[model samples]
Target: MKFILASASERRIELLSRVIKDFKVIPSDFDEQTIKFNGSVPEYVMKLSKAKAEAVSSATYAFSESDVTVIGCDTIVSIDNLILGKPKDKQDAFRMIKMLSGKVHSVYTGITIINVNFDIIKCDYACTKVKFSNLSNQDIEKYLCLEEYEDKAGAYGIQGYAGVFVEAIEGCFYNVVGLPLNKLNKMFGEMGINL
Candidate 1:
């Protein structure tokens, strides 16, 4: 059996490596924009994750493989019912960071694992509340200059320079980093994957 990760996120790969010995990454090619938000963050992420897992799990090679399990994950930042995804540009990054400044936001991460041959399909999510320290415009500007906000939701990464901005986290810290490793590990254990 081959373990596969249907995501292109480096953070997920890095986090997963801490438990699993090895796995293949087959990034899901689904266009996320196809699914519009329906006012439910959990539903949005879970559906997206399921789509990604099934996309890779349905591949011919996946069926040919002794039994391939594909893992899919998706994360987003929400504050006051507004879902913030990757920033479109530097300006957008500044805007996102500014809005997130000193505010409490929720980070949601959805995890999906599927192996059609074994009739295995798992979907779950973790939500973490993160409170950011009030950031000055200069601080936001400097962080944006680092350009780490380009591909990050909320225009800040808790594992990067932006870590200083986080004053508190009420739930799983890893969830804010894009994938909740602790939660994933527990789920993997339940699935008999000894991760």
Candidate 2:
């Protein structure tokens, strides 16, 4: 069987490598802006992930005949009712971090797995509670200098320099990193596939 990942994220690629060593990285053409938040973070992410997987699966179907499993994932950070995605600029990154300062936020990662041969699609989400310590302007400024916020949801990556900002996390650390291995294994098990 062939494995494909439907994302361009380096983080997702690295994380997925921990389980499946050989897989194709085929970033999906699905535009995230096409999906609107509908009050539920989990549902929103799941939909995004599914769209991503479908986009890649359809494209791959036309070129390959072998059995394939395509995985797609999406992550977002939420505080109160606001959803925080990747920052648009330095100012935007500062704003997101400022809002998360000294607050507990929820990081939601939605994962979708598609079995192309069987035409089966399964999707699920993992939520991890992350508490960030209070950040002064200096801290935010110093962090911004590192420029780790680029292309990362919540304007921060828990596995990077931003790790210092996080005081605690209540669920899968891998989820915050962009994929949830345990949840992923369970989802695969549901489909009678190991790994």
- Which candidate leads the pack in TM-score? 2
lDDT of each: 0.88, 0.94
Which lDDT tens digits does candidate 2 get at residues 98-192? 99999999999999999998999999999999999999999999999999999888999998999999999999999999999999999999999
Model 2 misplacement above 4 A: none
- Any idea how many clashes model 2 has? 0
The true-versus-predicted C-alpha distance at residue 98 of model 1, in Å, is: 0.7
Cα RMSD, each candidate:
1.3, 0.7
Q: Can you write out model 1's per-residue Cα lDDT over 18-74, one digit (the tens) per residue?
A: 777778888989889998999999999899888888888887363577777788999
My TM-score estimates for the predictions, one after another, are: 0.95, 0.98
lDDT of 1 at 88: 95
